[model samples]
Target chain A: MTGSLIILQPGHSVVTDLGRTKGPAYGLPVNGALDQFSAKAANILAGNADNDPLLELTALDFRMRATTDLLIAVTGAPLDLTVGGRESPQWEPVSVRAGEVVAVRGIRTGLRAYIAVHGSFTVPSLLGSCAPDTVVGFGLKLVEGFRLETRTTTAPITQPHFGLPLFRLGITKPAFTTNPVIDVTDGPDVAEFGDTAGLLFTTQYAVSPRSNHIGLRLGGALPERQLTSEVLSRGVPVGAIEVPSRDELLVLHRGRGVTAGYPVLAVVTSRSLDLLAQARPGHTVTFRRTTVAEATATHRTACLELERLRQTINTVFGLLGIGAGQRWYELSPASGA
Target chain B: MAATTTTTSQTTLDIYESGDAALRVVARSGDAETNWATVHSLAGWLAATGVEGIHGAVPTYDSVLVEFDPYLTSARQVRAFVLLGMRQLDFVGTTLREPRRFEVPVVYGGDYGPDLDRVAEHQGLDVEDVIARHTAKTYVIRCLGAPAGSPMMDGPDFPVPVPRLKDPRLSVPAGAVSVAGRQAVIAPAVAPGGWCVIGQTPLTVLDAAREPLVPYVPGDELRFYRIPAEDFGNFAGQFLEARP
Candidate 1:
């Protein structure tokens, strides 16, 4: 189907989907929508599948012209939005007429926002994900003149979507409004770091401006060095907060290097990791030690909630006459070995 | 403690819970051969097993990290599965595949390898001697990381280890071969790194559009040949490849 959208002012936006989760052996991380929770919500509102491609907008201030009438939704890290010069709200589906402009700016709360269009974007993928990763070369970064194709045909959105109750029922709101009290557990090096061990929770660390998709470089009280030399290099996880010799604490994110050399202090819990992704520079962070049981429960609750939303979306789409979109979720065409 | 099983002379197999999300299996420790074997054997078994939650393992220099869907399987349960695999692991019978070696053409010792003189001087060898020693051994792809498909390599530990540049270059162009602390790396994409530059290969180390994506994969072997700088443009598309 030929549906197109033209970029007016591309402000650090890239086509992204549920990231590639299976290629660490090939030197790739599970890269996807950094804020996956929001990514899913955006898709639901836009009447797309959970893994459909979305525009991952960093720090907002983006403008795009809807060349075709398309259903769209903006979710994650509240950004001031406007459609055709009119104030638009987030967390709800928005219908834009052909030639109408959908603009986003003034990202006050979070670092990233997901803008999903009805019927996923048909961007070229590397190894099955359309997510643009700086590390692993795939997909194109959105620029002013670039055009994006839609997987479905452009049928004008007529109904004003009332999906607020669905959102309320699904997806628990994060506790911390301004500063996230992200939950973390002891890392692999928990036992080895000797006496002054609880520095990760005890000391206050702020997100440094030097942070990027690769990692969040933090400027905080330097963890006392128990060892003088580097350890054996090994694969690091997404939320591993690796501590080098001195003050800087690096919390590896979705785009973490496949392997790491530094000793790890803590690993952020799966649910709270989304919050960490939104912790922009200068944002204060506090760590709360959580048990594996509690962490699993939290994740399970989130998954169940997302699942509920997905069911709700299924019903909504069925009523709207858009059958469940094709399976773009599978990472590669090759069947799972 | 993760149940330790199958003790070897050099290393032991152990597992660790990496965060709450996944489990890591250290098939073997320290030695590269044991580790490579453990990783391959375990990966092969797991892929064959096709367990619900076992996503698969990523190998490093001395370990294979098994990332899983925590919701479907716990660390304790995965450990039990791994232990079962360990029992079946015929370390003695597992044949190491004859490595596929690629001969990469490189232009050594000039602006491309700015630190070549420094590397030679520090190792107490002449420029030609340094080049000879570097080109002599076939390096194994130890790890694939940094912008994907970039190979962190290991070889016969250099008689004299090449030291890293005190200040790393802001951007080492793609296909630059460099070494530090007895290991080598071919920059798959232009990015800043600490490894001392030795030479540049005109070959596309990582072209996303390329069929195989990367010219080489981990566990593969590669050797470099000195080529004239002017000959770089002469070699277009994929470079001459040699497989063992």
Candidate 2:
């Protein structure tokens, strides 16, 4: 796909994919989409690979217009999506004609959303990803009035023919809960916190206003430590629930730096991290304890589900005479052509 | 969480599960310097081996965080890979490649180094004395972290550990040479930081467009030399290179 998308109303949006996997060794933080599940779903719906670069829109109000016909899908955060001034459903692929506008706004239940087009966005890749790192000011910085190009080679599908029938995927709407009980496994230093670590599960935490892609500073009963010694500055993983000397617990997110000095009491499960990403400021979250094996199994299941869905999509499209790797817009030019 | 240990020669590597997707390999028993060397050696070994499903191996002072795809590699499998790398590191010793040295040109005291006087006053010394002590010793690169590609080097030979700013600056300009406790770092990019910035370098420490984005590796050596503030504009955006 080789067309451009013009931002009519820019929100806090950035191009994201499964960010640089090898850059962390050089002190780079993984700056991918916060909600991986939704980002993948959106990409799959738009007939792209799971790791294709797409727009990750944080809660604000986003509006964009396409210069060519494209298949686009919006997923994550139960937001109101409007296409060409008409209400459209989220999570399903929708064909938009050239010059049609797509707006996503009024995202009350969650904090972020994913918008994936038929092809990946063309952005400067650092360490092999377009995901922007706000901390170091690296990668593409999206702004209002900026035009983003994609790899679409198809022309605008203006002519409507009965022979060409575009089909959208039938998917169950994902739930966006304001108050969610997240699952977490005990971290390596959980024992150092002593009895106070139990408070993590019992007390409800409200996502603090200071939360960002780097981390989520939760406000609630703080976890106390028995040993008041400083932890060594070492490599810390994303989703680590670190207990600082004082104040509330800070949960590391995707944009977290490679190493940190705080003590980690628990780590959010990989599957639960997708749900945690949607948590906005003031959203209540309670963590439940789980084993690593259980969490691992859950994540494996999710991966398999996505794989099955991908296969089904390919089969359906193939049966409809859309050749392998051919987009819906590239279907043999209308019957009378 | 269960901690697994692998003994290879003198170094003992302990693998602890950071999460389902990440495993942390720590030096069980060693001094800070020895542990850092052991950790970094393992990081280098892992990269050289290119183990399957291993996403990234980040080295710290005494630990290396190895991230992998949970779906493709299990925590147990990751532990085995780390143990295998540890064994390979024992054969190679700590040095994977020869350490390169760099002469970093820095302008101290003024708009470039706003906290130079503060550091000197806190240590009960003159700004010139502080600058002299900082440049007296050659430091080794420990690791890189914080604002991406920022090189954390062994501390300067200061009488006392310098304290970090109580309140971190919202944005520390790129190429800022900062210090905290016994460690020093050059802010490779513009980001929020809490370290005491005593000087600034005009050379570009990191650039994504350039191949080998960061010039120095973990075992590299660096020596900072004083430069006149008037020469700052003469070397702007110059890529930092090691001595030929």
Write the residue-wise lDDT of candidate 2 on B1-244 in tens digits: 7577778785777778787889888897667878888888888888888888888888988888889889998888888778777776677677747889999999998989999999999989999999998898898888887778778877888879888799989999989998888889898888889999999999988877764478988888999999999999999768899999
User: On a 0 to 1 DockQ scale, where is model 2?
Assistant: 0.70
Native interface contact recovery, all models: 0.54, 0.74
User: Comparing only chain A of model 2 with the true chain A, what is the TM-score?
Assistant: 0.91
Q: Report the TM-score of candidate 2, chain B only.
A: 0.96
Candidate 2's residue-wise lDDT over A136-243, tens digit each?
Answer: 566677787889888873333323543132555677656889998899988888888888899998999999998888889898898887887656678889999987
Candidate 1: segments with Cα more than 4 A from true spot: A153-176, A325-337, B1-11, B28-32, B47-50, B91-95, B155-157
Candidate 2, backbone clash total? 5
Clashing pairs in 2: A1-A151, A1-A152, A1-A153, A2-A151, A2-A152
- lDDT for every model? 0.74, 0.83
TM per candidate: 0.90, 0.94
Q: Give the lowest summed-lDDT range of ten residues in model 1 chain A.
A: A162-171
Q: What lDDT score goes with residue B214 in model 1? A: 74
- Computed on C-alphas against the true complex, the DockQ of each candidate is 0.51, 0.70
